[model samples]
Structures are given as structure tokens and as C-alpha cells.
Target: MSELENTFNFSELEDDGLDIAAIFGDTGTAEPLPIPEPEPADAPEDTGESAPEAERSQKQPAPEVEKKDAQADGETDLFAALAAGPKEAAKPARNDQKATGQVSLFDKPPIFSYGGAKDAIEDTSMTFEELRIAKADDFPELAEGKKVSWTVEYGKTTKVIADPKGTTIASIKEEIEKSRAFLDALKKAKEKDRNPDCLVKPKVTAQSKGIAGYKGVFSTVEEAKRSDKTICLIPARDGRVYEFRKTEMGDFIAPKDNVIEFSAVRAGFTPALPLIPRDLMGQIISFFRCFMNEWEEFEALAHIYWDKEQEEYTVFIPRQRVSKARIDADLRGSALPEERYIHYADIHSHNSMAAKFSHTDDQDEKATRLYFVVGHLERFYPSITARMSCGGKYHEIDPSLVLEGIGEEFPADWLEQVERCESRSDTLLRKKDFLHAFAALGDMPEESRL
Candidate 1:
């Protein structure tokens, strides 16, 4: 028997048929190791400096023990590998199961709580009392019998009223009394009803056509004849004409009222005296005399101004700047300085002819200013005529009224003086000449007249 076999109990092992040699890696059917080649002649001698090769060969694994040690080591490595395999993997599942169990047990999500200087507790078995409990250090020190009172009151409100300026208690009371009185009066007024007939207007009309504020249409002859509104035209039934309205009685006779006779009333404008100072009137006369003497032309023109600020009438001898004719005349001057004074009157001469307003004169004196025509210059006392074209009418004013404070060279009654100075009546002579001229023309045929 081998010494190794003698050292261990082999009888029981042999009866069990257990291969002990196999466990120890002693395979009976083993192959021998290769032998080394013999050294050549004349080979180099060994100095024995290196260790023996036998010892190297001895340190190498014996084939019989290699498999045995490998088997034992592999078993141990397998068990250890299993133990080290993904420790984090198994731990997470266990932790998740524990977390889920805790959530389900508490009927709420697992919450982590932190408290002052304490380790975290993840156990689900914690009770509400344990969570609510506080450490001794967390409470504050207090007196044994501290008292407190809290009150809540209801059913009351506060309001702020703004006081008006200049208001007193007496004024406020008076206003309240006035308001009550007004209300009482209004209530009493509502008790009485208004009459519908009282609210209606009366349908009344005036009797006289001349009276205004009446409800009818008719010719107001008396009122029109009395009024200052001059009527230019008056028609007749039998084609007869009358130029004037004569006063027969209290009521007046108009131009068309009397159709039987051919009569004439006031033909031209009625005159109104303008307000002129005595001194200014004299100056105006002197200005005309001087102006006529200066210019011996058939006709001459001049402008006179009334300065309201200075209260004086001044004459302006403007440059003629026109081609004058023997019988008729046209004149132009610079723009009158109306800003300084009113351009009140315009005067011109007719050089020994009759004092009359011409068609050109009508156009020239269109504005509201007094106009004068001086004629009968051959005689010592010349004829003077004054008029104003205002509100669309030639209003003849008395020459005496306009030239009030003049020297006695002019006549007081100029119209009478003009008649007496003439050799014969001009109107009769003109009528005689017109009849002779018509007689010479002979009677026209009826169709020719039409």
C-alpha cells in the first residue's frame, strides 16, 4: 500500500467506490514527460553561477495536482461570483417592495420627513401620535396661568358723512323744512286737474286790413300811403296816371285812388336836414366859390370831409386826373381816407346851366353821402341844389338848411330867386318847342305808332 493511502482511511472509501486518486488528480493512465537531448562535445563548461534547471522544473505544476486544484478553485469562484453578481439589482427590488408595502399599509404615498438633528426613519409602522410628538427642546417656557381673551362682535356698521362747505346746523334744518313744504305743495297740486279749454288759443282776427297781427290778406292802402316806404309804381284801371298821394281827409288819396284826373303829387324824394355845424356849413360854401373861381372849366368837382374826431368839415381839392368835357364831366381821385374821417359830401358846378342831377351824377353819388349841384353862375346869386341818395332814393334836402350860416351873397329862398332871374319860363318855352316839332313830323299811321 502507498504511504499516502495508508495515512487516510481507504477501506470505507474503496467500498463506496469513491475515486480518491481522481480527487487528488492521480490519473493512473498518464503519459511520461519528454527527455532532454544530451550535451554536444566541446560544449561550454558550467560555472554553476545560475541555479539548477531541476529546481525550475520542480516549481512548475505537477500534472496530477493541476486538475484537482482547478476543480476546487472553480467551485469556490462560482459561488463567490454568484454572491457578487449585481448586489444593487436585488437590493432595489427589495427596496421597491418595501416602499410599495409601506404606501399600501398607510393608504398614502411614503413620505420622508426631516427633523432637527435626527436620523431618517423609513418605517411604515409609525403612528400619528408619534409623528405629532415633539422633543422637549421644541417647546417654549411659559407661566403656569397665562390668560387671554378674544371677542367677535356683529350687527353694527360705521359710515362717514362728508360735511359741505359753508353749511351749518340751522341751514340744514331750513333745507329739510323747505323740502317738506315743496313735497306737500306738489301733492296738493296733483289733486287738482287742469282745464283743456283754458290751454287752447282763441281764433281771433283784426277788422282793418291796415292793422297788423291779423289772420287775413288784403291791400293796406292807408298804411302804405302814410308809411315812409316810398312806392315807386302805381297802376290805374283806365291807364290814367298820378304821381303824388294827396291827403283828402283823415285817410289819404294815393296815386291810383283818383283815376278821373291826371294829377301829380310829390314827384321826388322828401328832404331831411342833416346835422351840420354853423362854421362847417360856411366853410363848405366858401370852398365851392373858391373852387369854381380856380377852375373856369364847364364843370368842376370837389370833395369835402367831416372829421368826427376834430368835429370840423375840411375841403380836399383833389387832382382832376380826368378829361373834362364842356357839357358833361368825369373825374377820378385818390382813395378817400375814410379811416380818419367820414367822406360826407361831394360838390360840383354846372357853369350857368340849370341846377339838376344828371344820369352820371346818379351813378357817381351811389354811397350814403350828401351831393350838391350849383348852377346859374352868370347871375350874382347862383342857384344851389342839395340832395342825398340814401336807402335807394334821391332825398332832396333844402339848400338853406345845408348852407345855413353862409354870407348874404347866396339867397335864403334859392328856388324863388332862380325863377325870377330867368328871362322867360323855361318849362312853357320847352313845351311850345316840343309841339311845333311834333306838328312838323305830321300824324303817324296807327300801325306805325304800335
Candidate 2:
């Protein structure tokens, strides 16, 4: 008997998850191990064997013990390979059992959370207006002190691509003007409601008409009216058309009311601030009367000033070269006021002639300023006239516009009842020949305009 067989009993293994079938791999029904003929006690046992068989028996005994030891070592190695199992990849399932192996923590999908830091939450979930109108309490992490310190972004925006010269527009307002757009929309709505569109198109007509070599629409009455056509017709709208006819005096004549058109607008040196305590005109009148002479006439000069620090209108009598007709003063010379004081006007006396601007006055008073002329000093109430010189152009203004105590209060309704009556007059020059730039307001008669 083999010594290894005596040491281990093959039938005494416990069923403790050890795979004996795996250790001893796939022993099929074809074959079992060949046990060599053991060495006989005396001579080799021979029945009717050949002579070669007897020779093999002598060599077999020599290696019989060695063969048993080699087989025992190979079987022992099979038990050691049990834990390693099969080297081939495992099949998916056996007996409908689930396949399982060592699983990684990262193998499963990550669980998203909205309760972490403010930055950890995704911003793509909210829209632009939603972020603008939403409050801090609307967020989960930022609400109820979930985190003491956190940051959120809404007003600012990051560019999808970096640009060096990108610009953003921001609106600024002193007050929250919530209803301005609403008011404009309401006005447009009201206009549309009141005056809906006039869907009917206007009737347009084209005709062949010509006269006096002026082929199209006649600009003048002579062209529009021919020998056969005694009168000219025109499409009339809401306006006045003055008919100027050549009179015997070789002048185109029209009503004075229709010819003269003007409107009142304030210009250089309007009386906005109050005058100083000293009455400058009264002082000038007193000084003129105090130095009145019956011989030749002399002129005096004064300038009106406004002091920024004092916010008052003052008068300074400047030294000048004066005569009966002319008075010249160095306005911007050494006698000029300081930078804080603004020179507003220039006034001079004409001694005794009517308060009218002479040719010399227009030539000398070219600077932009208010000008005043006092005349008829011999009378109890001297005459005064006020005008503004705007860049060499002159405009006559009411004396009360600048001079105090020059007019009296009157009822407003009296203007409607007043009527101007004068004799007929004509000019030697035509209206086109003597035309200058002037504001032409619409024709507003006393009855309708008042």
C-alpha cells in the first residue's frame, strides 16, 4: 500500500463552501490512474508471460515508489488551488441566481442636492426675470440661516465668450417712475379710440391746365388769371391770404394789420431779478434836472450791472465823451466791472429831442445789450424809450418792460373794444423790394383772437 493513501482519508471532507470539483478539474468517465504492479515479496510473479514482460518487471520495481510519491504531490497541489477557482471568465447566471461582484461607490449615479452652499445650486434652472424678482428667502440653502455666509448673483451677468470692449446699459432715475409708460400708453389709446383711422382714401385728380407760359400751377394771379378767365380759383384751407395790388403810387398795398406780424419773446437782459434799493432812473432824472441848461444840449451815460454775490441790479454812471447827439463810453476798458458782476444794459440821455434812436446810436450800440434813451427833459415827465441790441439787430420794447413807474394798470377787456383809425397811406417801395427777416404769426384779428 502507498504511504500517502494511509495518511489521508479522501471521503472525510466537510461541506464548508470548499469546491472539491473545482480543485480536481473535470475528471471524465474515460480513465482512472494506472497503479503499477507492486514489487513481489520474493521473485516476480509469472504465469504464462513472455520473456520481455519478465524484463519489464525488473525495471518497474525500481521506479514504483517514486511514481507513488509524484502522484501524491500533484493531488496535494489541487487542494491548494481551490480558492483560486476557475481561471476562465464567469458566466452570467447559474440556476437563475443574480450575478454579483465587488461594487465601487462611484459606480452608482451621484445623488444631486439643492440644500448645499448657494454656489453649489445650479443657476440655469431659473430664468433672468425669475432671478430678478426672486428674493433671498425663495432659495433653500439661503433661507432660514442654513448657511451663515453665502453669495448669490443676479444683477450682474457673465459673457458666454470674453470680450475686451463689451458694454452694458444701466438706467438711472431720481424717482421710481412706474406710471410714465402707462400714461403714454393711455394717451395713445385715447387718441386711437376717439379718432379711428379714416379707411376711405382721399380722391386725387390730375388735369391738364396751363396759362401764360407758366405751364403748371400758377404762383401769381397774373398767370392763374387770363383774358378769358377773369378770376382765379384756389383750394382754401384755414389761413389768411393777403391780396397785394399795385396802387398809383407804385407800391403793393395791403392792410397794416395783415402786413405786420409779430409775437413777443424775451431776449438779452430780461428783467428777472429785482432792482436795488437805489432808484437809478430817479437819480438820473434828478441829476439831469439839477444840471439842466438852456444853452446847448449835453449827454450823460450809465450802465446797468448785476452782481452775482449780491443778486441785485445796480446802475453805474460811467465817464464818457458826450455831445448833443452822441455819447461814447469805454465799456470793457479800465472802468469795466469785476468778473462777478455782469454788465446787462447801457443807458444814455438825448437831452431834449424825442426819445428815438438816431443813426449814430445804431452805429455805436452794436454790442448785445439793453439800451435806453431819455429825451424831452424840458417837460414835466421826460420821455423814455427802451430797446434791445441783439448782435447789431435792434428790437423796440415797451418802456414798462425795463423802466419802473412808466405805465399804469388798465382793465384787460379794454383791449378788445379799442380800435385804431388812420388815413390811407402808401409806400414808394414794393413789399418784396423792402423785405427783411421777420416772424409771421398767423392772422389773429381782435374779435376772434381776443
Candidate 3:
């Protein structure tokens, strides 16, 4: 403190010779004061307007000022920033996230496995009649009153049983075995004597023949001519063929050669020889009768005629076979018997129209046409009546060809009209042109149309 006072006294003495010690606090008692240096004459004045030289020197350049001004004004210097700005740090990339839950790659759901899915099991507890009754209850329409037989399978042994009295389940099983054996034997015998190209015999009775038998049905005298292969020669009974061609009422002349006849009856006729059990025979007869009745209903709805005595539902189509050989050839690949005439009643059940029936050479295009025709008919006549009355199995006539025939026979514009009436698309055909086309097909046509 004494040194500090002495120094301060000296400094004050040098400055102005004033009483410095009295004006200043004691050095030991108070902190030393900071004295500002006296202003020099050479020092620049600060009027609060001009910035210091050093500060001016450190300020941003004119270009930088302009750039800052531009940025503040929302103007970006993309290129300049790219050249001058600090480079961005590169970021690390990440891989795709995987599913979290535990999963089994090859695990499969459990499925039931049966030891014998289709193999019939033997139940010695029940008799044959009980089994038949059970089966009949299951398929009452097809099996009721129908003789049923059974074959019981025990390990590797099979035992046949007959149910003549329809009494017990055990008897039914025995009959089933007998029936199966009989059928197998018959099948083997037929195979041994089978003829690959043999023609099928017709089913006709003598009572159903002759001009007197077909009296009012024949349109022309020639149609009445009975042939062994023909059912009945009748003119267009329903006038469908006459009307379809747009022919005049009187222009349709009855065809002399147009004959309808069934093939010969099967040779064996005895009740037992037929091999069909009485109960089964009743069922078969009922089934056929129902089929025929339904078929007639269908025909009547379509305005087509069904001649019961003739056993034919005649509808006009463009083509007919000249010989049995031709018919066989046409039906070579068919599932139906080659020589047998397929009844309209059984046609839907057999799904014959939906089947492909063309020869191998034609690329099976006829199947598509057949499907179209069936679909068309189904659409128009959705009812059972439509199915029966639509008539004819594979009329075998091309629609386009029929159109051409109609064009040539009627007014030139008629063909165009027919074309316009054809279905635009199969889906639409069901509701639109189906019934019209079906009715048109049934209409009578001029002779020249064929």
C-alpha cells in the first residue's frame, strides 16, 4: 500500500500537481481505479457517424453485401452457394426392415386323412334290405322301388348278396355282389363278341307302322312310306319349317321322301332275359315316361309337335344323313351308341349337345358352334318347356349357311336382317336373340332355301 500511494502520488504530480492522495481512496482500503488515457491531438474524432478504420477494413466486401441483400430479398444464389458453402456431411444408408414376428417357412395346416375314401366298408351288423332302404332314402327319386344289391368287403374277401324280397341289409349286400358279378360276366362276353364297326339295331314295333297308323300326321303321300329304319314319314307337322324360311303359306310342299322311323327292337325280350330286375324295370320305365312327358312339354312350349306314335319330335334342320354308314361315321367319336337315335328327353341328361361331335379333320370348331346353339336355346327358353320344344339334336346346319339360304330364298335384305338379329355377344344372347333365333329356326322355309 505504501508503494502504491507513492506511485500514485508521483503520477499525480507528473500529471497536474494536484492533491491526488486526498481525492483518491487509500490503496490498502479500496480497489485501484482505472484511469482513461488522455486524448491525443492526432487521434481521429468519433462523431458516431464514421466507423473505425479497423472495423471498416474487416467489413464484408461490396459483392458480399449485395449477395446478403439479395438473399434477404428471397433471391437465392444457387451456383455461388454450391461453390462457397460448406459441403454437406454424407449420410449413412439403411437396409429395408424385416417383419418382426416369428414365422414358419414350411409349416402346413393339418389335414384329415381317411384310410379308405371310396372303398365300401362291410357292416355285417345290417342286413341287405336295410342297406337298400337306406340307399333308397338317400336317392329316393333314382333308387326307390329299384332292386339294389350289395357286395360286402371283409379284409380281402368279397361276398355278393341279392335283395329279391327287399327284406334285410345282409340280403341286399349279397344281391349287390351277384349283380356285380353278373354285370362283369356280361361285359366280358360282350367284349369278346364286340364288333368295332357294327351298326346299332333300331327299336320299333309292328303296331307303330303303316300308312293307316300314321294317317293324319303325314304331310305328303311319300312321307307315309314305311321303311324298316324309319319311324314315320310325316310332313312338317308344326309348320315350323314352313314358316322359318319366310315362305308363303301355300309354297311349302310336303316332302315325299321325308320319313321318320325307329331302328329294330333289341332281340332279347323275355322278362328274365332282359336282365333288368322288375323293380328296376319299373324305375326305368318311370324315368323314361317322365323324360318323354317333359320333352313333350318342352316341344309344345316351342310350338313344335311331338308325335307319340311316331316316337319322333320333328323340327326342321338343314341336313340329314343319306345312309346309316354316314350316320355312324358322323357319330364315330361320340359317347352315345353309333346307330341309336338319341331321344330329346334324354339329351340334356347326356349333355350330348355340349359335347364335341365333329370329325377329326375339322379342328373341332363344331363344338364351339354347338355350345353357342345350346347356350342360345337355354337363354331364350330358360324353362323346361324351352328345353323340350327347341327340338332336334345337332341340327347339323350352320347358322351362317342358313342365313345365306334365307338371303337367297327371300328378299335380299332379309339375310341382313337375320344377321342383325344374331347375338352380339354370347352373354347378351341369353336375353336377346335366343328365343327369336330358336323360333326362326323352327319357321317354315321355301324349297330353294335348302
Steric collisions counted per model: 1, 0, 46
TM-score of each: 0.30, 0.32, 0.16
**Per-residue lDDT for 172-286 in model 2, tens only?**
1101112244223323443223212111011112332333232223245555443233223322232333333333564342322332222344554566756433377788776
RMSD each, Å: 51.1, 32.6, 42.0
Model 2 quality (TM-score): 0.32
The local distance difference test score of model 2 is 0.47
Q: Where does candidate 3 stray beyond 4 Å? A: 1-124, 164-450
**Highest-lDDT candidate:** 2
Clash pairs (backbone) in predicted model 2: none
lDDT-based ranking, best first? 2, 1, 3
Q: Which candidate wins on TM-score?
A: 2
The C-alpha local distance difference test score for the whole of candidate 3 amounts to 0.29
lDDT tens readout by residue for model 1, 1-450: 432332334445434543323212232233333333334435335657456764454354344443343332321221232234422212223334443332111112223222323333233244322322322234222111121111111111111112322223222222322343422332233222110000100111222233233112224544446555333223446454433333434433345454333234563443243455657644554554553544563566777777767776677756653223233333454646777777777877776578898887876678877788877665576788899777546888886655554445756687665655545678789889999878756787666654
- Sorted by TM-score, highest first, which candidate order results? 2, 1, 3
Residue 190's lDDT in candidate 3? 34
Output candidate 2 Cα RMSD.
32.6
